[model samples]
Target: MRILSAPLLPLLVTFIPPHVTRAQTTSVVLPFRRTFSLSVSASPIILSLPAQNEPYWLSVALCGAILPYPRFFVSNESDVTLPGPGGVQGSQTGEELNLDEGLITYRAQMSSGGALAIWPSSGAGANWTIDVAAIQDDFPTHRRLSQLPLLGDTSATRALIFSPPFFTRETQEPIFPNYTFQDAIPSVPPIPSSAEPNTTLLLFPTANANATVWLTNSACALTSKLGGVMTTTATRTVYRDSSGWRRQWFVDGLSASTNYTAYVIENNAQVSGPSYLRTKSDSFPCPLAHSIPYCPEVSYAVPLPAPPGSATSYTDDNIPQDIKA
Candidate 1:
């Protein structure tokens, strides 16, 4: 998300000749599919005021292209004072500036006065300028409505304009931090202790760019006994991946028949939901053992005797019977 450092003011100036010899009226037609380059010195521009207890809105209008969905974002630089009312009074610093860049499907009516005002809904003031140019040399062929009407000219020309100069203001309020965890899964299936030993576990989540991961044993008896438990292991690194796919390795030291739970910690302290896994049982016989104790030197050819007066159950001729001779 891009944060606003200062307000962008208009720069381009155009004079339109009156069609009816009346006072020349000005209309702005924002071009579609154009790269807008705006440069403002930090000293002159005013940072918006922090939003207080209420939500703030920033509105922007587009003439050629449709408006975008409403989005809210906080600025990185804050507490900036610009020349304004009351000789520059200090306001909320470093608050989020809500922007409503909604898509404008309907074109501006040429007959009606052609002036679109783009401002924040919360009325937080900002100093910024917009520069618009055609996306391509040729404009879109689709015809909808005529462009903004100039005082005397019948046709509208593509150009950039700025809102009337205004003071930057913002409401101040406590903002809560938000986080999300995602792409969490077991790295590998539970493996036997005696088997070829490289098993691992992994998890991922969407967190701030600087977020970190923490692993904890959720179902451990000690943790259950105590209301809160310290994390058994933790790893911290800058959040390089936005997909949140983090990985950790679990080498072969786990005990048999033991269940373990894992979790991801983001942004240093925020904890994610726990995932459960169990170590392979140790009770199962080790396949490497050579001696067989249950049936010593047992032969596969041996057959069992049939029940008395019952159908022959033994298929082999040499049936093992009690030696009573």
Candidate 2:
């Protein structure tokens, strides 16, 4: 299924099977994740964007908190009954639709009383809305907004964290001759850059001859695959001196604490030795306590307490666990 437009009125989502394709589309799948308790008073529109074609926001996580189970359909639009005005008027709901090379991105909308909160999938989005008792179906979307500054509704509050967004491939690219027998090593810190700091930057790095998978792993075990794809060129790094391939593939859509299987399917024909990977937990900009695959450097932020000109002192209880570890 796929969604095309996100205007305030009649949000048009096409319920197409995964086997079909669409020529007119700009949809991207968002990595399944959570939204921490942050508030933003904007239009009632949620988008699922693939990392490769991410918009200017370039965000990694998202969440939602709705009430009365807004409304969704895989077949009949008229069958949907929303609390307020605004639904498929000119046409019937649940129109059979086909999709594209992109995995899927059907559509959804909110009622006047619905809330929007986001948090990581590891925890609830403040409270999970998608996992409510009223609804019991596994659709394409997850419930994860944790903080809605002034939300007043209460129905689905059990939050749900999610994995990263990705696109299902119709066929795999042919493996390069030089790409064979090489390992795809994942790297980030010990030696870091501004965009890829030792602990903060969420970008994952991996390289193997002409192919690179930023998802992390060991020197010989072949760690794993991270992120769907990046349109930009690969960057070279000398972080390891001369131990492995100098070229690096920085994957943008890496998922935290998730397992991925890596393999090469040349021209969708011959398959080679596949590698499995599991990414770290903590992520950039998320200061929550103890996210999986965590780094000891990150933590929930605390304001500096001592005087401006004084040397600061922090007790063991006040220190972040990761830093203390």
Best by TM-score: 1
lDDT of 2 by residue, 76-139 (tens): 1223321112242222233222211111133433211121211112111233222111111243
* Candidate 2 deviant stretches above 4 angstroms: 1-60, 63-85, 88-238, 241-325
| Model 1 quality (TM-score) | 0.18
lDDT, candidates in the order shown: 0.23, 0.25
lDDT of candidate 1 at residue 72, scale 0 to 100? 22
Most accurate candidate by lDDT:
2
lDDT score, residue 246, model 1?
A: 28
What TM-score against the true fold does each predicted structure earn?
0.18, 0.17
Which stretches of model 1 miss by more than 4 angstroms?
1-244, 283-325
- Superposition TM-score, candidate 2 onto the true structure: 0.17
Scanning candidate 2 in windows of ten residues, the lowest lDDT window is 151-160
